[model samples]
Target: MWVLIFWVLVINFLSAQEKFTVKKIVFIGNEKTKKEVIARELSFGVGSQIDTSDLAYSENRVYGTGLFNRVKIWAERDSGDSSIVYVWVNERWYIWPFPILGWKDRDLKKMFYGAGLIHTNFRGRNEKLIFSFALGYDPWIEAEYLNPWVLGSKNLFYSVEVFYQRVKNRSKILEEEFGSFYERHLSFALTFGKRYGLYKRFWGSIGFKEISTTGEVPYMKTLSPSGRDQMFVFGGGFRYDTRDIPIYPSRGFLVSVGYKFNRLVNCDCFFLQGGLEFQGFKKIGIGLIASRFFILNSFGREIPVYSHFYFGYNERIRGYFNDVFEGENIFGGTVEYRIPFVKQKFFKWNKAPLEEFSILRFGVDLVLFGDFGNTWFNREKVLKLRYLSGCGVGINFILPYDLILSVGFARNDTGRGQFFIDFKGGFE
Candidate 1:
């Protein structure tokens, strides 16, 4: 009996090391996505030789595309030393005509509403096209187009956007002094980007903006003597991303750097700006820990109120959840440990009102998080400035269509905790 057990163990060990050549590859459930798009992410081709364990790597590569909710890859042994590879994927619905109803910080006075049409996988090639219009606190209409793989552009990517908006200035100083008013903005931009392999990209953009203020306020407008200015925008950036999953990555890091120049075409108002960002994720036991840090600064004559950085407006330090911190420069960081409450999977609801909304992928995660940040004042020594920070716990709801919403609580130096709502990890 001992001899029989030893022989069986030896056979199993030998089989695990065997390599097989792929005779063919088969795919299933990729009805909307093109075959080439899926094949481009594969690590092995039809004639490639691979170990059985390598199929898992291929599965992750396809899943990273953000087009599929579920992906599975396997191999079938043949009579010879060759195998048939099978790849199965569940594609997400491509088109959505959805309504938008939201408020800033749940403030009913800051309410805004709109409707939009989105085609994520436009033409089944991972392109995106959006058309939207909104009415309320700040109303706007916009259109955007993105093509990652242009048909005849040497494998380059491009995007175009145009919009017109009535933007109400969110400056507390302006509102406190002169009173609240609206600004007008009409802008158009074009960008071209190139991806090196899978995880790196470099891009450049150029655009024009015509902006005017209803009220002449300090730090609100460029020097055109008309309370309006026409400016040219130029920017370039580089990125390196290797996250296993973009929405809730468990491992990997993302590094990004960008610089921008906003200059009046005919006047003297201009600003030069640059920013650096780093986000990393790692698995610890059954949970994951993630951290993000970013710094942005500008140089030139004067930083407009609309362009200045702030803690409470566009950004936040957990401790000062309801407070605003503004200055010449801004920097901050956050750390989070996320434990899986419910693993993500697809649920079919046959009686749903819309077919695209029928197949749902919902998940819940419990998160422990902390945040710290401050504005950089030129007059004050950088080392002497005190930073604001806070820590708290929350629940993350991963909804369908790659949306994330958080309900959380945090406390700052005042020892008073504040309940808050955030989206997309509030990383940026």
Candidate 2:
């Protein structure tokens, strides 16, 4: 009996070694990009034998670049040596455009139109350029441009961006007895940073921002009030990311710290402010995010508009609008589950579709959210704890554009519910 078991194990081991072998590799459709560059992105290479177990890992490495729409790998045996490996990739276009629409209250709605263009591998050097513009119904417009490059003879990456924005507040006669004043401002920022591998991966950047806004609103001018505030921001923060993707991080912690100098354009009080953010999760697929801000100065203190203490959209909870709760010292959190389904299969070259619009996916989440922050100074005393508890379901569609359109619905404890329909990037 012992001799029979030994003989069976030996035969199985020999068969496994004979099943997989690599001789050479050929890459097609990569002109401006170096073949070696693409080869390094793969988990398997020339002279290395391949197995079915390694296929998914190789596919993920290339698709993670956000530059390819489709990738296919094939193996052909060479009667001379061993087996020749062939890798074929279909690249996506560099430029794209889209529109945006969102809702809050029935009376207060928001709409925007925007487009962006990105160029990868420009001039045969692995550099990127991005340009975008947005215009909206709330009477606002913004434009920005970004350039990122890996520094000469170094692994360091740097980027520079310029932005301009203007907004006007319009009143609804039926919604309120009095009208609301508008806000207009102009601002500019400059940023620089480098990536490092510590206990985990991290990126740090230092930047400066200058913003000036007008104080005279139609209502403020008529109602005897102080006008306008101007602020200058100079600070630096480091971000630690363990997520697989930067744009849509599934697991990681993102923390930012900054200081701002706020001076009323023509007033007596000038203040200094500090901010912090904490975001991270466990791989069992649960995530958490929290942020806070504080101000200290010779004059009256001011909380930055970008600072929200607890409640809002995309921060602690979904199915809500941005900055829904205006206040100092806000906090929010979310719990989610991520489950994946589906396996890849091979087909004839011409018969295979360029993209899989939908890959099998399953996700369910329970959320408990609340805000204990307020916008006005000394208004913290009046801050009430508003809480909402709900559950949500999502459907994912994977496509050539790498965009995902998710339709979700949630019901709150208050008996009020919300239905959300939005694009989850990389699926649309």
Candidate 3:
């Protein structure tokens, strides 16, 4: 009787242990991101017996992708067959609507509203499509497209874009003119290249662009001589970038050279431009940028259209307006001190409300910038060496979506101050 009882207890314990083992996993609450992607990142998988000891590790794997806002796992016992494992996920919404505010100098000049829809993952493919529109108070619509891949390869890439924009400008001497203009632009580029060792990269591409415009003249009458003008450009260039990121590069160098034929069929003019960028650091980060441009008519005469150089803004100097200074030769540099400010993590993986990850990072940057450039119809006639300098403070926020947003204010040597905001993806 005692031996029989011991045998029965042993059988029951074995059955219970088998029941707790996981044979399969089922995923839910995924619409944009794919299940296969999440599965590959997970520590647990089908046919693997469930181990409560590794639950935390499993959760961390899923959260690292930044695709989910929440994730959950559970199991159910089956009466006849293998136990069923359930993986529950909550998806983050893919749409955002926000306001846009910008200023050229110090005035709160423009107020606009914008909306965007992003699909980081679509149809199990890691593809993204974004659509955005902005309506200025003057009521203009600007649209653009960013296609990271067309051939679907990491080495070869293509980007095609079309834009239509209209705006009213305030005349320099006369009163404001409600001048309306329509512009249609199309650009296509093909690139092939590779990244070398750490801190070295090179890529080259040939591109074509067409720009046509019809509108009244505002600010500059030369831009529209006949009240309507059109330009077609074809060019190819080689680009070498060593920067950590193209948008907000922390360190690296970039060099590009290109020649364009403007009004190819009509005006028959040639334009050449080249630029070099250097990002380096000793104790503080420093960025240096310089460019030169030349334009010549079919008859080999210099043209005024290509006689100007543009400087300022996030591209060259920080804490400045877009295209604030114009010349034929541009030289600009910025020095910044990057410092960590705060960091906080939230959205526990087990308690995640959606199939998304959480990230928190904060930093402060002190920056000093200088810009100098000259413009002339002839290269021989250029401004002497002089630079405009400014210094500022900034705050940075790094988010899970690989987004970096920065806000800053800087004052020039002339006592004029400017406030600016910038953002970039992939790198800070």
Candidate 4:
């Protein structure tokens, strides 16, 4: 295929380049990110043999940090067997204090709007800090921090989060027959992670969680028989990513697996849940083909209804509204093809601060995608949920703040279609 041919050509080209010892590694055009942080991401340092393929990997790693608008890396041959590797980066605005008005579901009717302050590269060390409050259908106040290196150890990483959320859990089955339930949850967690080489990360976390509901459903009696539901939870996970970019990957593979255990603090309720996700991307000519697969499951005592796996919300599928289905297990797959229509910089400004940092560039991408999924409540009912599928097309606007605004139209197998708007690039 065209993708295979492209890789073959790239391999041949890289093989033809004469490897040289790196005399020095230099960074240019970075205004906020620390040079030491950038150097740590490089595959080759001074006195190391510089391979073109390694340079490409370093470029991808730097770009993946989501700190730069453009990354250019090249090696200039020096005298004898040495060469100078130059890395030039156009830094993005790292701090964003912006208003947030967005759909709680893909549907415009369910709205959650708020304002938040986010620092993507705190202190120029690739650390992230976020504080936000959202209102309307699902309301929450949350704060989180992420650091790839803890205590200056490259292999040690950590993340901490604390949040309080009030959610109205509406069920079509409940609405048509009984009434909806509202949940108030408060939780806090801290996680430690260790890096295994360049691509794999292992992490574990412990947390306290509490759930209180305003109304009871059919499953509530089994969920919190003691009328008090609190839990001490523990979880662990691992991830492997080699994508060209985290926001819009054009190549490479990503896989993650994780599990959680809940031990009730006030009741006998206990359960275990786990998930696995995989994504792959391939460049073929001018387009990138991407695919995703995921599975979610729970075992031990049946999980609380509020803890059940739900799909059709957020990233599950394009044509469905939020939380359309719920079950103990869910599985799905998606395939998409993406291509940029405007690959060139559309314009630029030469104003004061804009002149030095203001390279206003614009680009648009086209996406065609299809998704298929099913959910299950029990072993006997595995795959019993009717297969749901959707197909859609979208226009993505590339903009400052590392944002991708998306406008899309989609139709499901049920012959229902809708128009949706969304943004990409945020911690989940």
Best by TM-score: 1
Find the 10 residues in a row with the least total lDDT in model 4.
6-15
Across 23-116, the per-residue lDDT of candidate 3 in tens digits comes to: 7778887776667666655556666665543344455445444455556666677644556777666665554443555433222455555554
Between prediction 2 and prediction 4, which has the larger lDDT? 4
Per-residue alpha-carbon lDDT of candidate 2 for residues 1-428, written as tens digits (9 for 90 to 100): 22233233332112242346778888886656556545655667667777744554455455556655556666788865468777776565544454444332222345655666666655544456666666674333444433333554343555555555554432233114434444555455555555454213224334333433344333232111343454454445555543333333343345555555554444454555555555443334222221222222221354333232334432323445332443444444343333333322223344444333222222322222222222323344434545444445444433333445545565544445576655531200
What does candidate 4's lDDT look like per residue over 1-428, in tens digits? 22343344332111366688999888998888889778767777899986787788788778778787667799998899888999998887788797878776555777888999999899999999999998886889999999987666568898999999987764455455657667788999999999876678999999999887775453452367654478999999999988766766656789999999999877666899999999898766566677889988889856676766667665456677444776778898877666778773524455736433465546788877777887677755664457888888888787754567778888888879887777742212
Cand. 3 TM to true fold: 0.55
Which digits, one per residue and each the tens of the lDDT, describe model 1 over residues 3-97? Answer: 23323333212236578999998999889998778886777898898986567666867877878867789999875988899999878777879
How many clashes in each candidate?
0, 17, 17, 0
TM-score versus the correct structure, for each prediction: 0.86, 0.60, 0.55, 0.86
Of 2 and 4, the candidate ranking higher by TM-score = 4
- The lDDT of model 1 is 0.79
| Residue-level lDDT for 110 in candidate 1 | 76
| Model 2 local distance difference test score | 0.44
- Evaluation by TM-score, superior candidate among 2 and 3: 2
In order, what is each prediction's RMSD in angstroms? 7.7, 10.5, 16.0, 4.1
Q: Give the distance in Å from residue 421's predicted Cα in candidate 4 to where it truly belongs.
A: 3.9
Task: Give the RMSD in angstroms, all C-alphas superposed, for model 3.
Answer: 16.0
> lDDT for model 3, on a 0 to 1 scale?
0.45
